[model samples]
Target chain A: MNESPVIELSGVCTRFGSQTIHCDLDLQVAAGQIVGLLGGSGSGKTTLLREMLGLLRPSAGRVRLFGVDLDDPDLLIQRTVRRRLGMLFQHGALFSALSVFDNIAFPLRELRCLDEDWIRRLVHLKLAMVELETAHGKLMPAELSGGMVKRVALARALALEPELLLLDEPTAGLDPDRSQNFVELVGSLQQALGLTVLMVTHDLNTLAGLATHVAVLAEQRIIAFGPKDQVMTVDHPFVTGFFGADRRKLL
Target chain B: MNAIPCLRVEPGRVVLTGSWTLATMLPHLADLQNRLAVPLPAGEHWDLSGLTRLDSAAAVLLWRTWGNAWPEALEIGELHRQVLGRAADLPREMPAAVKHAFHPLESVGRLLLKAAHNLRGVIALFGQVLLDLAYLFRHPADFPRKEFAANVYKAGAQALPVSALVGFLIGVTISYLSALQLKSFGADLFIVNILGIAIIRELGPVLVAVLVAGRSGSAMTAQIGVMRVTEEIDALSTMGISRSIRVVLPKILGLTAAMPLLVLWISAVALLGGMLAAMLQLDLSLNYFIENLPRAVPVANLFIGLGKGLCFGLVIAVVACHFGLRVKPNTESLSANTTSAVVTAITMVILVDAVFAIFTRQIGVPQL
Candidate 1:
C-alpha cells in the first residue's frame, strides 16, 4: 500500500476562455483514504474533481491516478483501470423510461458481457445493500423520490465493485436525516468494501463525520489540506470563515 | 339571383343542406363553428364528404372555421393531413351542375389525354410513392408498437365506414349524374358500366389511400417525430439498435401488405353500391350487373387498383418518415412537417392516379 500515492496533482492550472478557475494546484490523495474536496459555490471544486477523473486536461502541470497518466492510457492497464472506477453524478441522471432494476443494470450491461444469472445476482445484492427491495425494481425513476434516486445511483455506481468512487455533490438536495444516512452509508461502504473515495461537497456534517482527510480549495489552489483535525484547526481566513459559517449553521 | 334557392353547408364530415348566402350563412356560421368545435379526429380525414353543394363563401367559412376549430398546436403531422384533407374534399362539395359551370378545363383535360396516349404520370407518381415509402425507416428500431397499431387502426381499419359510404355514394352519384345526361341519349342502361369503371379504376384506389394517408401517415410522422425529440431515439443509438429497421420496417411491411387488400375491399364495396344504385335507378338486376362486371371492369382493373394501393402505401410511409425525420425538437417544426406529409402524400397520390389513367390508354402497355 506504500508504493506511491494513488492520486497526485502537481501545479495543475485550468482556465476557461478568459477566467482561471484552478491555479497552480498541488494535492495528493492516498489509497484507502476517503478525502473531501471542500469549497464554496464559485470555488471550482468540481473542476478539480474533473481533472482527477481525466475528463478535463489541466492547463498546466499534471494529474496521475493509480500511477497512470490519466490523459494517455497505456494499453496494458486499460481493462484494470476502467474496471476499478465509478462515478455518481450530481442529479443521479437515471433514465426516466427505464425501471430501477434496469437503471442499476445499465453499467453492468455496458461494461461486462456477463450472463443474466450473474448480472441479476450482482444487481440484486447491491440493491438489497441499498435497502431497496427486489420488487421495487419495476418502478421507474420518476416514481422514486429524491432519496431513493440517490441510493439507486449509488447502487449503479457500485455495480463494478470499484476500487475508487468519485462522487460530485452526492448529498446536495437531501434532508438532514437522509444526508446523515447517506454519509453513514458512504463510510460503511468504504470500510466494508475497501473502497477509496474522493468526493466534493458543501455538506459540513458529512465532511466532519466521514472524511479521513480533507482539503479546502479556493483562489485556484489547495489553501489548506491535512488530516481531519489538522485541516479543521488551521487559521487561514477562508478555512476559519468557511468552517465557522458551517459551525454557526450547525448550531 | 343566378344562384339556386338552396345551398348546402358542412363543417367536417357532417353536413347541413340549405341556402348559405350572406344572410342565411351568417346565422348558420355560428352553428357550423360549434360543429367544427368538436375536437378534430387524430388526423385530417374528418369525414367532410357531406356537403352536397359548395360555394366561395362556404369555402372561406370552412377555411376560417379551420382557423378557430383547428388545434394547430398538436403534432404537425395530424394538422397537416386534416387541413389538406378538408381542402381536397372542399371541391367535391360543389354540385355536378356547379362543377360543370366551373370546370372549363374538362375539355382541355380530355384533349391532353387524347394527345399523350400513355400513363407516364401514374408510373412517375408510383415512383414518388416508393420514395416516400422508404423514408419511414430512418430510425427503424425506435418503433412504438402501441402508437403504430393505434395509428394503423385509425388510418386503415377505422376508414371502413367512410370507404363503404364513399363507395356507395359514388355508385349512386355516378348513376344519377349519368342517368340525367344519358337519359337524353337512351344510354341510361350504361350507368352501371360507367360507375363500375370510375370507382374500380380511380376513385377506389385513390380515395382509400388518401384516407389512409390522412389518418395513418400523419399519425406515423407525429409518433416518430416525438420519439426523436424525447431522446428515446438517442438511447437506441447508444444501444446500437437501428431505429429504422426496428421502428419503421414493421409498419411499412404491414401497411404495404395490407393496402392492396384494403383497396380491393373498398373497390368491391363501391361497385356493389353502384350496382345497387343502378338497380334502383335503371331497373338492372344485381345478377345482370355482376355478370357484366367481368367484361366491363376486367381483372386488370383489380390488378391496377392493387398496384395503386401498393404505390399509395409507399408514398404515405415515405412522406411520414421524411417529415418525421425533418421535425426539429421545437413545436413549430412538428406542425410544418405534419402539414407537408399530408399535402405531399395526397398530391402525389392524385398525380400517380392521373399517370395511371394516361398509361392505361389503348396502346403498348400490357393489360394486367
Candidate 2:
C-alpha cells in the first residue's frame, strides 16, 4: 500500500538551550489512523507535537504535513497545508474573553463566507457532537468546568473539519469517567470523520482503548512503534517498565 | 455555498430550498425550532426535496430540531438522508442553563466592598514590604541584588530618553504661553519667575510621576501579573523563595532609588527648554534666564520636587505590586489589573502632590 503519510518526521531533533529533547526521531502517520504518542513527563511529547504543528522548529531534520515540508519557502502553500490540520492545546487555550459559541464560531468566522445563521447552526451542531447543551454555548471559558472546557475546545477544533487532529494531553486534569467519555467521544468522531489523529498522552487507558497504533517515546527516541499489542511486547527496558506497570489493564 | 437557504411555511407544510450549506445564512433555525415546538396541524410535513444543495451542518441542525430523529412525514434524497441520519446519532446532552439575578443596591454594595478589600490588600502589601526590608537589612547578603539592578535598569536607565523628550516639550509649551501673556503687559522678565517655579517645584515631579506611572508602573503590574498567571510565583514559593523579597521588594527599591534621580534629570531638561523658550519668545538672553532662575525659584524648590518624586515612586510601586499580586489566573484579569494599577498609581501621585502643596506651600516661595 503506497498511501501517502499525512504526517512525516524523519531524523528529527529538538533542543532547548543545552538540553536535547529528541534525537534522530522518525515517525510517519498515515491518514485515518489514531496514533497514541505515549511518553512520561519531560519526555518531549509536547515538544514533538509542537514541532509537527510548526510551532517549534527541530534543530535537525524536517517535519512534513500532507507531504509538504512546513518550512516550505512559499508561505501560502504552508498556510494551506496548515488549514488541513487542527490542534487542541494542553490547556484548551479557549479565549476566556469569548463565549463558547463565539469560540467555536471563530474558525468559521475567519473563513468569512458563512452568514451568522450558518455559523450559529454549525456551532450548535459541533457543540452537540461534543455532547454540550445549547445553553453551555453562552458561557465563558472561565465559567466552564475543566471537562466542559475540553469539550468546548474539542468542538472548536472540529468546527473546521480538519483532516488531521493533533491533541496534546487531551485527558489531563479530567476525572476518569470524564476522561473515558472524552476518549469515546474522540474515537467516535475520528471514525465518523475519518480523521488522522496524533494524540500526545501518558494515559495508558487511552492508548489501550483507542490507539490503533502506538509510539512510545523515552530517552530521546521512540523506544517502540507499531500496533499497540506489538509495541506493548517490545523488549526495551522503558517499554517493559511502562507496559509492566499497566499490563493487567492494557491487556 | 453560493445560494442562501430559506425555509417557507404554509398552513401544513414546510418547504426548504436553495443551498442549505455551511456558507448559507440560516438565521431562522431558532425561530423555526420554536415554531415547530408548538402543536402543528396533524398533517404537517417537512419538504426538503426542493433543496438544491445540502451539507452535514444543515442536516445536523434539522436533525437536532427534530429531536435527534427523522421527521414523521418528510421528503429527502439519499445524500441528504445519510447526513441527517448520522447527525441524528451524535451525542447532545448539556446541563440546564444558570440564571443570574441582578440587584442594583447589592451591586453597589459589592462594588464598595471590593474597593475596601483592595485598599486593605494594598496596606497589607505595604506592611509586608516594610517587614521584608527590615529582614533584608539584618541579612544583607540574602538580598536579591541582581533582580534589583535589572529592575533599576528597566525602570530608570531605559526610561531616560522618553522622559527627557516629554519634559522638554511640556516646559517649552508652558513657557511659550506664559511668555506671550507676560509680554502683552510688558512684564516679560516675570516669565523667568513663572517658568522657574512651575518647572522646578510642580511640573517636573508631577510630569515624571505621570509618565512613570503609565510606562514603568503598568509594566510592573503586567510582568508580575503574567508571572502569577503562569504560576511562576507559586513555583518560586515552592522552591522556598520569598516573592516579596525576590520580586516585589526589588521593584520597590529600584523605583524608589530611580525616581529622585529621574526628577532631577527631568527638571534640568525642562529648565533648559524653558530657558530656550524664554530667550526666543521674550527676547531674553539665555545667560539672564539662567542667572535669574536660582534667585527666582530658589534651591529649596528642587529639594521639594525630588521629595515629591520619591514619594510618588514609592506609592506607584506599591500600588502596581498590589494589583499585580491580585491578578487572577486569566488573561482578562491580567489586563484588568494592569490597567487598574496604572490608573490607581496616577491618582495616588496626584493626591500626594496635593498634600505636598498644602504642606510645603510656604517653604519654597520666593520671599519678595
Per-candidate DockQ vs. reference: 0.01, 0.16
| Model 1 chain B: ten consecutive residues of lowest lDDT | B90-99
Runs in model 1 lying further than 4 Å from the true structure? A95-97, A111-113, A245-251, B1-368
- How well does each candidate reproduce the native contacts, as fnat? 0.00, 0.13
Residue B276 in model 2: lDDT: 91
Candidate 2 on B1-368: residue-level lDDT in tens?
23567778877788888877543433454564565556556556989887766656667657656766567799987656755765665545433335579999999999899889989998999999999989989999999999999988998999899999999998899989998899889999888889889988999999999999999999999999999878899999999999999999999999998999899999899988988988888889998988888889878999999999899999999999999999877788989999999999999999999999999998989988
Deviation in Å, model 1, residue B332 alpha carbon: 21
Q: Over 4 Å off in model 2, which ranges?
A: A1-4, A9-27, A38-44, A57-64, A67-83, A99-102, A108-140, A143-151, A216-226, A229-251, B1-59, B64-69, B73-153, B168-191, B235-250, B273-291
Rate residue B77 of model 1 by lDDT: 31
lDDT at residue B154 of model 2 (Cα atoms): 90
